[model samples]
Target chain A: MRDSLVAAAFELFLERGYEQTTVDDIVRTAGVGRRSFFRYFPSKEDVVFPDHEQSLADMTEFLAASADSDDPLVRVCEATRLVMRMYAANPTFSVQRYRLTREVTGLRTYELSVVWRYEKTLGDYLRTRYADRRDGTLRANVVAAAVVAAHNHTLRHWLRSGGEGDPLAEVDRALGFVRETLSPDAVPAGGGTAGEQEAEDVVVVITKRSTPMWRVVREVEASLGED
Target chain B: MRDSLVAAAFELFLERGYEQTTVDDIVRTAGVGRRSFFRYFPSKEDVVFPDHEQSLADMTEFLAASADSDDPLVRVCEATRLVMRMYAANPTFSVQRYRLTREVTGLRTYELSVVWRYEKTLGDYLRTRYADRRDGTLRANVVAAAVVAAHNHTLRHWLRSGGEGDPLAEVDRALGFVRETLSPDAVPAGGGTAGEQEAEDVVVVITKRSTPMWRVVREVEASLGED
Candidate 1:
């Protein structure tokens, strides 16, 4: 019944336009009573983001279950994948909703609120994991935002491509860039035990801007072998 | 006149609560006509975020003026500082709004929408700068989101402290971390000319996870001296 209502509402929205289409019109088109429509969705905006609440819950649960991981960032990335998959599960519905939301200012604002919730959830999970670290709260918020941004970047690309490509692969690649960039070891601070050791042996050799690559490589190899 | 209306609105909102406070009550409190109130603010919610629109405009102008810089990210960070200064300029008012928004879900959502516009502005600037680069769009979006997240993290910390202390310093530090972490050099891709030279000359040394840092450092010095 809920699916039928969503389908009917989408048809009405596309045909009659979002602002012009009323709940009465949607209920009439869906062949469902007003009470059923009210039970399923709170308002017209709610219908446009039908699966967001459920997806958010699933993401929270997924993160909660991975509380023991060594790297919370990895878990956050995985949780984001769950969201991507939810959209991928029904590309047609997702694409239609995306177009409608893009065209409506209110719906776009609503979508931002939904996206904020996801970022907040991811940040909350990371906060717990990095509670003892300095600037943990800030780190959690920044990393969560980066993950969401990367996911959205890939998701939008797929949507613009009519949802035909492998969005999961694109998202994974984007997430990989984020992880490599913002991971604890990548940024400067108290280099962990391993990081400190790596830092000690790694001689950061800076060459002239116009230095040739072959000479630099040969110089590095010779330096390493000299010991 | 606008400031007086905002002050009146805030007073009425505190007394009657956000949801219960009507536009009529605000006009009455300000001793202003309904037309004047409407001219200043479109809705009750707009009063809570009076400076955001102007702040966003300033940021856009700042970025637009720096379109030809070698590193657009530097300009983006500077633009964000303008927003920080705006809030810092009126600490008491900012703190009060922060508290009220925290207590009201609708205002909080509205605030998120405002923040999204800032992020979008930064992303739009970055997208143009990185247009010809690989994964440029994705990189632009992720970096912009990271910047906004970092700024918000610091801003919230200051607000939670009742708008006391040095928020600009804290924000600069946070932005510095982001600039270092997500900067073009931090992420992987085609190494620029100088980067390629540095990359070639830099022979990464990996000591065992448990290796003592002093020993690793001594070995590195010895190797360099041997050459």
Candidate 2:
């Protein structure tokens, strides 16, 4: 019944325009009672984003259930991938909604609010993980925003391409950039091993050009020795 | 006239609640004609965010007038400070709007739209600067979001403290983290002189932990010799 209602609503939205399509119109087209349509969706706009609430809940659960990895940013990035998967699950429907959303200012605004909720979810989770760190709130907010921005960038590109190609691969590459660029561990600090060692270790050193090459070399050697 | 209208609207909004307040009541309270009220504000919600449009324009102009610094991200960060300045320019009103926005869902949603506009402005500027880069759009979006998130985090903290502390200083610290963490040049890449030589040149190198300390030393020595 819910699926039929969504189908009926999308058809009417496409045929008669979003503003012109009413609840009565959708129920009549679906051959369902008005109460049934209301049961499935509270309003016309709600039908446009049928899967968002479920997706958001799924994302929240995914983040909550994640292992306490040393790099919380990685967990946040993985959580966002779940959202991408939700869109990728129904490319045609997602594409249609994306196009429709562009035409309706209210839907666009609604979409932004939904995106903000996702960001808040991610930020709230990170805040708990980083509660002990100085500037944790700031870090959580920035990382959350970066993850969502990167995801939207890739998602919009995929949508614009008519949902062609591999969205997951594209999103992974974009998320990789965020992880590399904004990971807490990526910052320069004294070397300390906290998490399980990866196959490779990376050390980043920043120095002035005017400094002697020998001195820079010595600092690297010293840092590597500490590791 | 505009100030009086806004003042009247806010007073009524606070006393009678946002939903209960009407345009007619606002005009009556301000002792102004309905035409004057309409000329100043499109709706009751517009009165809550009186400075946003002007602040957005000011920010756009600030970005446009920025010197073509080699690191465009720095210029973008600087442009965001102009927004911080706008809020700091009037603390009492900013705090009142903040409180009212928190209480009203519509105003909160409207505020999110305003933030999106600001982010779009920043992202559009960055897209042009990074037009040739491989991940220009992704970088632009991520960096723009990061700047806004960091700014909001600090601004919210200031607001939650009842507008009591130094917001600009807090914002600077937050933006500094963003700049240090996400700047394009912050990544480890081969050194090359591009912009005006600063007082000091910085070199960053990343290498596998398994690499022999001696080998790591040699690579740095070798790279320094080329310069």
Candidate 3:
């Protein structure tokens, strides 16, 4: 029934325009009463984004189920992938909604609010995970914003191409950046620069003068990771 | 005259609530004709955020003046500070607008669009600066969002505190994370762990046994820069 209403809403919205198409028109086309429409959707704007609430709920549940051992950065990347899947699940509807959203000022603002909710959810999960660090809250918020920005950049790229190609691959490449750059666990490979820290790293590899560079390189890595 | 229209609109919005107040009410309250009201602001929502247009223009101009020597990350932080200063310039008005925006969903969404413009401005600047990099667009968007998130987080903190405290200090503290973590020029100080690098940094010092440790450290630093 919800799907039917959404289909009807989009049909009327595309044909008669979003502002001109009333809830009454939607209910009439869907062959349902006003009560059914209200039961399913809170408002007209809600109909345009029928899947987000479920996707958001799924995201919250997914984040909530995260294990203590999980890397928060990787977990965030995984969580955002769920949103991409939701959009990918129904390309026709997703493309339609995206096009509709761009054309309407009110819907554009409404979409922003929805996007804000996703960022908040991501931020909340990360804040808890990073609670122990000195800049935990700030890092959580910045990383969350970064993840969203990366995801949206990729998603919009896909959408602009009319939802063609592998969005998952595109998004992964984008989120991979957040994990690589901002993840503390990923930092030691290069040191990790955000600002000032323990000064420049100084490693003294005391391999034999005849030792090959590769073996000396391996020894240096093993020693650095020990710290 | 423009200020008076905004002042009158806000006063009317506060007294009678945002939705109930009409443009006529604003014009009547300000003792200005309806034509004058339209000349200053296109709609009721515009009155709530009168300074953003000029501020945005200033921000764009500020960002456009970026030189090749400038660090894009730091430039973004400085650009966002302009917004912080604008809000700080008018405490009473800022507080009132913040409160009003919180109470009205419409205003909140409207504010989001204004924020989107700012983020876009920052992103466009960063994208151009990072155009030479592989993930230039992705990093630009991520850093842009991070800057705005940091700025908004600090601004809201100030607003929630009844607009007290040094907003500049709070924003700098927030944006400090972006500069520390995302800046490429800032990356060398930490070795940078974003991902796998040149295996590991192995610095071999073949100094005499009597050489000072500080001298060895300086030699290692000089060699590392050569890479």
Positional deviation of residue A167's Cα in model 2 after best superposition, in angstroms: 0.6
Of the two candidates 2 and 3, the one with more favorable lDDT, higher being better, is 2
What TM-score would you give candidate 2 relative to the actual structure? 0.89
What is the lDDT, from 0 to 100, of the residue B224 in candidate 3?
A: 48
Tell me, by DockQ, which candidate is best: 2
Instruction: Look at candidate 1 and tell me the lDDT of residue B87.
Output: 93
Flag the better candidate by TM-score, 2 or 3.
2
For each candidate, what's the DockQ?
0.34, 0.57, 0.31
Q: Which stretches of candidate 1 lie over 4 Å from their true place?
A: A190-227, B190-227
Report how far residue A74 has shifted in candidate 2, in Å: 1.3
* Pairs clashing within candidate 3: A180-B194, A190-B191, A190-B192, A192-B192, A194-B180, A194-B181, A195-B180
Write one digit per residue (lDDT tens) for candidate 2, span B1-227.
99999999989988989899999999999998999988878877898998889989988997888666657777877888888888898898889889999999999999999999999999999999989876888889999999999999999999888888888898888888887667575442222222111212345455665667676666555545456
Ranking by DockQ: 2, 1, 3
lDDT of each: 0.79, 0.82, 0.80
Q: Estimate, for each residue in A51-70, the C-alpha lDDT of model 1 and write its tens digit.
A: 99999999988887884745
What is the lDDT, from 0 to 100, of the residue A60 in candidate 1?
Answer: 87
Pairs of colliding residues, candidate 2 = A208-B201, A209-B201
Docking class of 2: medium
